[model samples]
Target: MKKKIYNILSVCLFALLVSACYDDEGNYDYHEISTINTEGLEKSYTKTSYQDVLHLEPTVTATGGESDFEYLWTLNLTKGSGTTSNKIEIILDTIGTDRVLDFPVNIKQGFYDLTFRVTNKSNKLETYQVMSLSVVTKFSEGFYLLKDMGNSTDVDLHASDNSLVDNIFLKMDGEHMPDAPVSLGLDPGYCFVDETTAEYVITKALTVCTEKDVRISNIEDMSTIYTHSNMFLGGEAPEEKPYYVWRNAYGVGYISDKGAYFSTQASLWDLLGTGKFGFPAMVNDDEETKPNRNGVFASTCFYYLDELKGRFLFLDYNGSLHTYSDLDENNEEKPNKPNGITHHLKFFGKNYMDKKSTGYALFEDENTAGKHYIYQLVLGMDPFNPIEKVTEVATSSKLNGANLFAVNELTAKVMYFVNDNQLYMYDLVQNTEELLRPTDMATGEEITYISNRYWSGSDNADKNFDYLVFATRKDGKYKVYLYEILGGKPYGKPVRVLEGEGKVVKMHYVDPSMSMVSYSYFPNSF
Candidate 1:
């Protein structure tokens, strides 16, 4: 018992001695914490674009503990209140790690918060600044407004959102747009082959023509795929720019001072085309028939004479200097009448009422140059002479002095034309002229251009609506009016009147759905 008590007391004494040695009243010293500051950062940035360089150089300052610092810059997409997954932040990327951030803005268009953080390495103290950043792309979707400004061209884009992106040619090409506009043609899609790799991609292609040049480009970004000389299979451009360029599902071809060149033949084995236009189609590749040049610039171009698919008959009214050729789907010529007397025709289009083989061309007799005779063709499957019968159009003074003609593509049910500042619609079936406006003539107000296009709305895959549009110039200013067609006459109120710069040469609506590789794919050689 005595030994146990001694052992326990000894253990307690050793524990107490150790605790007393460790416990001490000591004077402690404290060091100051490090701090960081960013003073030169802007509160927000606006008008930024894709492929733009986002320059961020904030003045940073750090004090106390070693003064060593680390930098970071991060981008996060700014989502709105009702956006999906409200709790999660979309961290786009860590754009930078240095004090000065010279980041190339490669992210798609969106509102974002750009953050810069500086950390004091010695004390682990951090400071950050967030700036509002917005990225925009004008090329996303829009109507390319090709305007004639006399000395130079202004290819502006009226965005689908109603925002105007002016002078897109200068903004994109870094050069002034060329002037003396020849033609601006649009195909559903074009396949461009890489000049070096021989690889190809189908894209939204647009043909632009000036007095000096003819070029094809991807309409989405206005990026050039082929220039003048490179557009032909011979590797030589036309000495004269094409006065008119035309394309359809059947072929892509152009008429220049030289002659006609076709880029595609629907019957050819290579439906994709050779990526360049070939020489004019020939009869057994022997005799060449250039388009009949009736007037300067071939004022009266060719038309599909019958309900036939690919046979274009260039009208020759004055003489038999030109002969009609029956081109098969292979674009090869066929025997005419088995007698060799090719028919010569002068075709005036009521080229409206589309979607079917409704061939409506007003045949111009040799004597009646200014008269209108509407002819709707009903013919055999192999129409040797498509014109079975003709309807003599009743004469009217309203048609007098009427110069411009616009056939509505709603299948030409009604055509719109202006006479002496007055707008009129001629019913092809009724064989009558109805004046849409009376006392419409006012001094200093003149109608400039008129046409029709198939348009439904933005992002519209099915172009269902047909609108008859016309432009008027008053007091040195121009405005275009759009009217929807219901039952052949312009229905209801004017859909919209667009005011633009200079003279509106053409308006091409950009469909976002056209950007896909296979969407509306056609054999447009480039």
Candidate 2:
């Protein structure tokens, strides 16, 4: 009986082993597998900025499996391109459950074609699917400006045209560079030091590229000196000089570390003191000697007024603007300040105006009247009569915080700060005030102050003009928004024209003739 029991137990063990084997084997009716599901073999991929990697996701399914199944994947580009076999593979029993396949490896940037195939235990083969994808190369070109504190450098390039031009560099010569460089009305053309030496200088080019024959002293002197700052023809004779007497032609306006300030008429190379205005009144102080009497009023803003001659403006930091008139009449040696020069104003705030100028000025009532006013100034007017104090258009309680105001010199339309986020426009001719609330513009729910710098295209050269540009912070980044000046005011939804990671430090329309724009960017950090 014991022997019989042992034999029975052995038989039972064999049966159990066979049962386990059956369970492990995939169960599918081969006869029923007449159709294979290639739909399960769908594959897709995504491309990234990374140059080398290729990512793939593939899904596979089969109608029936009589035995173990296997999958083979291959990648191919165009014809004649080599093929990668089994770049990815799976055994239906063990790894087949995974529908997504990830292939992480470096691949060239180009078009690629891929295919996947599968085979079952019966040796029946099937082409799963074919896919095509593209890998693009990444490259972009444009202009950029770099600023370090008061020192600023700009690089402009015509990438598509393959033309490289307009590179400007302004380095503060003193302790630190100011935020703005006022236009001293110095000519950026040929600067003459004395009647004999002539130096060709372009503002954009001088900032970066070095000229073969030019000397720094030559440029510096031309930039600072007025009388000798102009170019004389080959046959022109030098005027008899007590050279000192010639200096009276050009007046020195303001000087900063970026460069000396002289009338714009002075050639690019004239020396500073040689001009008519001489150097700005020198300040007498113990802490630090004021370089020029202009005194270091404020360092990071600019203001400009466009007049009949051209555009007259001053950089807040430099206290001067680029002037062509200074170049025509004034000789290099006798640099003369641009005529009709007026007082400079500086506004302070984080998003405060980076620059100011144009038909108006910000003034505070002295009577403790708690009223701030915008005054239209006559360009190049006698400083004493700088402002006829036109009309009391807009009033602001926070005069100290107001950084900028703009006037449509053509329309005589004034836009000023009623509050941080609220802007009001007064038509000088209409004598009507209109409120421009942030909520009205689809710039998000929160109302924020629009940028102080405002621009209207020449289309508005006529009273019915309609396009405008201004800076505003939205979605966490500062962007220049383009708005249509409908009916003489900022109206309608604003479209983003330019965007950058950094804040726009300053923006100047490249005059009305050209569609180009000159803007400065200050990085987030200092």
Candidate 3:
């Protein structure tokens, strides 16, 4: 009887093993998908900007396949002479027979062909479909001015065609910004997008609104591109204060009460945090982490000030952020770098002279023995290792209380800074300062803001007719003055006078060659 029981147990164990093998075999079926078809599919789409998502949902039908199958959707962007593959892939999790594929597409203005691949238990099949997408914006070629009109802010566009459109935001969308406009960040019209095209953008701040508090618009028609209306308004205002905004080569990067945040040209106000939207943080885990992206301003020559870290950061071409100390380890100048902890860092946006150069300048604050000395950083060296060049240019306590600073290639190595209504010229080469008092203008009207071709194209490559535009306020009115600098001084009386512009708080000149030379101002109270 015991031998009989052993024989039965052995037979039962063998049967169990065979059953497991059969189930495993079933996982690999010999099914094949046949006659896959897509219905009600659109072959072409119109996309306004990179932020606009093109929704494509097509009904799919397949026959002669397993009851359920996996789906994959892919879009291959055409690069080079339409030979290279710029692929974006998405996989569907759920298995299905007859289904609809929901795909959202965001890419630069170009053409792309999409494909869908289906996989069954044992067989794989792919279907190819070609489609065309067109993207165009009115802000592509123009000079844009974002104005604050107490109740609501508006935008003005001076198109390349010499046509001026006033309050274009309202004309395009029938809406104004959230509140009174505080600050505006405009690209100096650099073609960071491609060799032939540039996407001009405008970033502005509002007074009263919180959610969707910041607005970024396209310069083509002053149409709204992206708004940080709901998502980012909860954090502390990043501008350190309202009416102040920070910008880089292509996007608006500012320190919010929350943290450092930035958005790109293609993606207006996504408000990407560090390492989130491919933004190269000054410090990251690895240098080879992210890909070089074309979303920001100048990939090679953009610098930003991190007030929280008390350090100046440079964004390299390959989506990496580095400081002067982080550039080269063996450099002798690395040791003399300022201790961000011991000394305070005061950064002036757009204060440096050359916007297109590899280096910029700033004031290093030192506190000792109840006396303070302001050191001017005339960084003329490259960020990466090469030859040892001059970095720190000048230092003086007399250059304090400077509210406005600007640099340009036309002025050669000279820099201009405004302190308490007095305009002082600091020669970065000679290491000297000259105070020039205006002869005829408004008394007690100190220079509130100053702008020039510093932020113009190619670091002042087109400096032949470059002029310095300054703003002053007196008797509740704002006046803009333009002076041509010859022999390192204001050559003549204000060549251009734009009087009666109410409360001219900020000013910038688009390269005259790029757009018709026009300036727009906002009223004190609208």
Candidate 4:
């Protein structure tokens, strides 16, 4: 009986060993799983004003008829002129019945044909559908203005490449309101609150005020008038406050909304006031009180003096011209004065206290009286004063309130005001002015002084008029006009570029190279 039991035990042990060996044999070492079956593979292309990263779908199947599997995916850029080596390899450690691999590719603007291949443990071969993605980069070349729709206080930028003009009404928190709106000045890149927290955030990302009716003030009232009613108020008005103006240089920088800065003559009261009132205010002054009292007084309008230097010149209300460089250190404590280098050019009219005084002086060079009745001072040196000279190029009658822009370093141009409906191009070298009429300037009855400022472009180096963009009032509405500047002359007639449903406030050329135009509009206050 003992022998029989031992035999049974030995047989049982042998059988168990055999079973283990069989199991080991069943486990196959696969160099490559069969071709992986790729699912959720798709490709598409699009164009946007900004650069964007795209994500592809999660890869699904890597079937190779095996219980356990591994996956390796390779992206092959078969066709493209750019760096064709744009490829990625994804090694999937987890592969099962329900497991799916994910692959992502960053596609830029262009055409591309992409192929995705996957390998699995069983060496099974499967290919995802070849995706032909043609991403056409779409961009609008014209200028854009971003603004807050609710309180009309938050101004920002919106650019378009095409010619279609649309009114961009700011809505609080990304809500669009066509009725209640604030028009922007011009395209000045993005907009944001001049605060530490918001820093350089785009204007659209800001929180909109739930209530409106903040007092709105013009550029002039910010300094002398300390009352709230004198200011343009948006957002919620404080309850029965002491009528104190915020005094916080809130909306006082370059009007990115209008593509310009405030240039107003500083009043004597403002010069002695407690707050910094102008664009290039006094640099050294008490922060708690007012700062910087030696610069141009407010009474100027902002002008893009030079693109290369990125400096803006403005005329102070004191009849002086000041240049403010965007590349300046900004201090929140004393917010009025720009912390960068500030140049001042006082343009005391031939005689103060004479409203009709025609002549002016370049205070920076010499305070001497000059014979030329300087109606306007375009900052930067001209033939008269070659090195950093401020040229008195236009008279009030010729340019009127028409915005002055630098056609080039040596020459300044202005859209002529009144019925002549022409552009006055002044040659600093020749000391001459040329009249460029795309057509008859719209009649005075059609537009107002505050209508959209004239717009044009000049390639000073080439001595060629690049393009001319302007706006006119028609049927109590503002319309945009585009004219190509060819061979130092305008061609054909002005083509209607954009027509909007609101009152046009300002228009600007995006660049001197293109025919694009950016315009701003506000609703009619009927």
Q: For all the candidates, what are their Cα RMSDs to the real structure?
A: 12.9, 24.3, 17.5, 16.8
Q: TM-score for each prediction?
A: 0.58, 0.36, 0.50, 0.38
Q: Which candidate leads the pack in lDDT? A: 1
**Candidate 1, residues 198-267: lDDT per residue as tens digits?**
7444445667777677777665457777767687887876576455454533455565645555665221
Which is better, 2 or 4, measured by lDDT? 2
lDDT of 3 at 9: 100
What ranges in model 3 sit over 4 Å off? 1-183, 187-212, 230-282, 286-299, 326-335, 338-341, 349-360, 364-398, 438-440, 454-464, 510-526
Candidate 1 worst ten-residue window by lDDT: 517-526
Error of 4 at 513 (Å): 16
Model 1 stretches astray by more than 4 angstroms: 1-137, 170-179, 196-198, 257-259, 265-274, 292-355, 362-369, 378-383, 391-397, 438-444, 456-464, 515-526
Model 3 per-residue lDDT tens digits across residues 1-526: 9999999999999999999888443466565537666666677665555456555566655676444556665555433211122222222222222345544333433334455455553356646455554443434434445555456766554554556566666776677655665555543221122113432222222212222265544343343444443224343333322322234434434333333334453222222221112222446643321211101123223444444554555554333456555345455554334224244334332222344332334444455332322333333235543212333433453455566665534445666778767887776557678886554556678566665533343233544345666777666555666677675566668765665433444444333222111111111110
Descending-TM-score candidate ranking? 1, 3, 4, 2
Quick one: RMSD of model 1? Answer: 12.9
What's model 1's overall lDDT? 0.55
lDDT of 4 by residue, 1-526 (tens): 9999999999999999998888444756666544445556566443331344444545545444543443333333333222121222222222122234332334323334544444344444444445554432222224433222233333222234444434332222343432332222222111222334532211111111112222221111111122223222342223321111111111222222112222221111121111212332321221111111111111122222222232334333232334443222331232222222133332221111212211222222123222232223322212121122335543443433333222321112222223244455544334555666666445452332222222333333432333454555555455555565443344677644555443343333232122101111111010
Candidate 4 weakest lDDT stretch, 10 residues: 517-526
Candidate 1, pairs of clashing residues: 352-411, 352-412, 353-411, 353-412, 354-411
lDDT (tens digit, per residue) of candidate 2 on 1-526? 9999999999999999998888455866556543445554334443432444544444445556443556665665432111111221222322222234455434533335556665664657554666664443221122222212223323222222333333222222323222332211111122223435442222211111111111112222112222222322232323311101101122223333222333332221232222222332211211111121121111232323322222233332232333323333223322323334332323211221325323444434545344454544333322222333444434433433444444433333545444455556655445566666532344442222233333333343432223444555554444455566555466666633454332333332221111111122211000
Q: Any idea what lDDT model 2 has?
A: 0.34
Superposed by TM-score, candidate 2 places the C-alpha of residue 486 at a distance from the truth, in angstroms, of: 3.5
